[model samples]
Target: MGDYEIALGASTFIKQAIDLRPDVGIVCGSGLGDIVDLVEDKQVLKYTDIPGFPVCTVSGHGGCFVFGRMGGKNVCVMKGRFHPYEGYSYREVARPIRVMKLLGVKTLIVTNVAGGVDLSFKIGDIMIIEDHVDFASMVGRNPLMGPNDERFGIRFPSMTGAYDKELRAVAHQCADEMGLGDVVRDGVYFYLAGPVYETPATSRILRGLGCGTVSMSTTAEVITARHLGLRVLGLSLVVDLAPVGQADDAVGPTHEEVLSVANSRSLVVAKLIEAVLRRITV
Candidate 1:
């Protein structure tokens, strides 16, 4: 917890410096950092300047925090995220969310790049995560599997309503108003601890389990946010298609490919997020 104290101090310093009393928090993934450009009165803070902050090394991820207004609401946006694959502990990965709670973030909007396993899904499509199956949990690892901090939350928090229902409805309504209803789909997301993409056989098994998309992150953050009593919403950009069966010429999608897809689809995602910001209340 001492390590986390260093991070908390850093967050406090940033909060004071930016005069940021954020009502909402947004976590940007892959090429989705462009949304920060839309913020008004932006104050940017580099992760390195913050105490105990883990800097991002992945390409397309800008390691900075932005504080500003979007759609008439005050918000803080993470232009990049720290992942477990980056050699950070689960607690370290979830540290930012805990700090966000301390900084008064009541709602969290998390976004990520995912591979479409559901045949009905197309590349560049956006899927709203209705629920998640944590493959990490089945493998004896979990973000919450640590010393309980009573100051933050209870020992056992109910995850039955992790994703806020009202917020999701508002997102759908916003999409409908923007004529993007067809592009917005709702489905279960499956998390696999990875720096590597899944194999065809593994993809098939996940698809059979009703997973529409697969990603390496998001679930840990969701759990942390929910434990802190924040209303959570997740949106994923489908960057590649997970085809079933072996092919002699088949090549797996690269991180660059994922970023490319995210870049192209960012326009739609930005619009959806901005619209939701304007329409959602508390």
Candidate 2:
């Protein structure tokens, strides 16, 4: 079956079950699945239960979809997301996003736990994605690399300002109101294909490239969302620090550390998201 048909199948099942047209879509990152708990009148569907969906194997990811209302807006939340490092192709990694588009999501809010490349970043800091460097896409591993499906989008979708400026402004305002102005900032997110954490040398290269944060996910999904004409807002929780200093013996980041930090700060991230959602105009 075609990509559109596959996405349609999943979205159709969701629609029939929830019977609600969501205006917003949310993808919760690692250790951040609790964000879905903020949703009211929730109806959940497991990934395994949804046809044409790839189940997430990561520990922190909940592997389900929660449909409900948040910030006075109807929304669909993905408790977990797929990744290329998980042995899924880019197309499969992007399926859930296309499903979001089919479900009538006009705006998408994506969140991820990332290693902070910028020295100024603290473990619990929130980085609003101003831009991104998709290393995977640059190397021909993009979600939209295959045959163009006109039904989903044009052959060439402009990614200029893919992270919506208006939505970002709303996020900043919400942050300020929550007194999180100091820790909340915007920066470039560098996307790398990773099942393994970065090496000291890799971290140095990312720093030289002007990346503020680095992670394995988000970019591909954002690309697919943009292709489907969805406005996007990306948030990165700095769960671990990238390797710094010239010392070769300096320890790098680890998954356990990332999850530990994410777990501690998940509530703050959830609150900020809720604030942003409340002010969003559909």
Candidate 3:
């Protein structure tokens, strides 16, 4: 089936569960599922139940979508998200974003747990994504690499300032209000095709390339969101620091460890999101 048709099918299925049209959408990352607890009057729908949505396979990843409210604003939260490392293509990973757009979502607030690539970052720090280097897509593995779907977007959607600057500023202002200024930082993030953690040398290389954080997801969905005319903002929780300068004996990150750290900071992530939602205009 065509991608547009697939996204329309999923959006139709979600509409069956709740009529609350969300202006803002959130894709919860890793063990950040606990943030769903902050959503009020939520209607939970499993990914499998949706006609074309991809089910998450990784452990600690929830396989559902939630329609709820925070700051009295309608919001749709994907309690979990698909990833390439889980055997899905980039298209599958980006489908939920398309579906959310079709469902009337105009803004996207994406969150994920990433390994710190920039030594300046500390574990539990939340990095605001000012830019991204889609290493996988840069090699032409992009999800948007296909026949043009004028219904979704033009064949060439400019990637300049793909992440909304105004929304990002609002995010930092919220963090400052919450006394998290020191813990919240801004930087460029890079994507890698991974189930494997980055090697210490790789971390150093990525840092040299100007990446503050690294992950296996987010960039694909952000591309899709921006292509569809949705304003986007990304937040990454640093679960662990990459061994950029540590000795050979230093430990590295693992999926289990990332999820554990995500659990410990779910509330902090949710508070920031809620604050952004409350202040975002249109």
lDDT of all predictions: 0.87, 0.91, 0.89
lDDT of 1 at 242: 80
- Please, what are the lDDT tens digits per residue for candidate 1 over residues 1-282? 463575579778887788868899999989998888778999999988888888898888899989999887899999999889989888788888988888889999999999999999999888998999997865757678867777778889888879888988998999899988887899999998898898898888999999999988899899889888899999988999985787554567898888988998887887789889998885
Q: How would you encode candidate 2's per-residue C-alpha lDDT over 1-282 as one tens digit per residue?
A: 999999999888888888779999999999998898789999889999999999899989999999998888899999999999999999999999999999999999999999999989998999999899986788889999979999999999988999999999999999999999999989999997998887778888988899999998999999999999999999999998887766567777777778888888888888888898888887
- Candidate 3: lDDT over CA atoms? 0.89
Model 3 steric clash pairs: none
lDDT of 3 by residue, 1-282 (tens): 999999998888788777799889999998998878889998888899888777788887888988989867899999889888888888999999999999999999999899999888999999999999987877878789889799999888888999899999999999999999999999998887888888888888898899999988899999898789999999999999987555576788777888889999999999899999899876
Candidate that scores best on lDDT:
2
Q: Candidate 1: which stretches are off by over 4 Å?
A: 1-4, 247-249
Q: Please report the candidate that would top TM-score against the real structure.
A: 2
Candidate 3 stretches greater than 4 Å from native = 245-247
Rank ordering of all candidates by TM-score, starting from the highest: 2, 3, 1
lDDT of 1 at 254: 92
**Distance (Å) between predicted and true CA of 87, model 1?**
0.4
Window of ten residues with lowest summed lDDT in model 3? 244-253
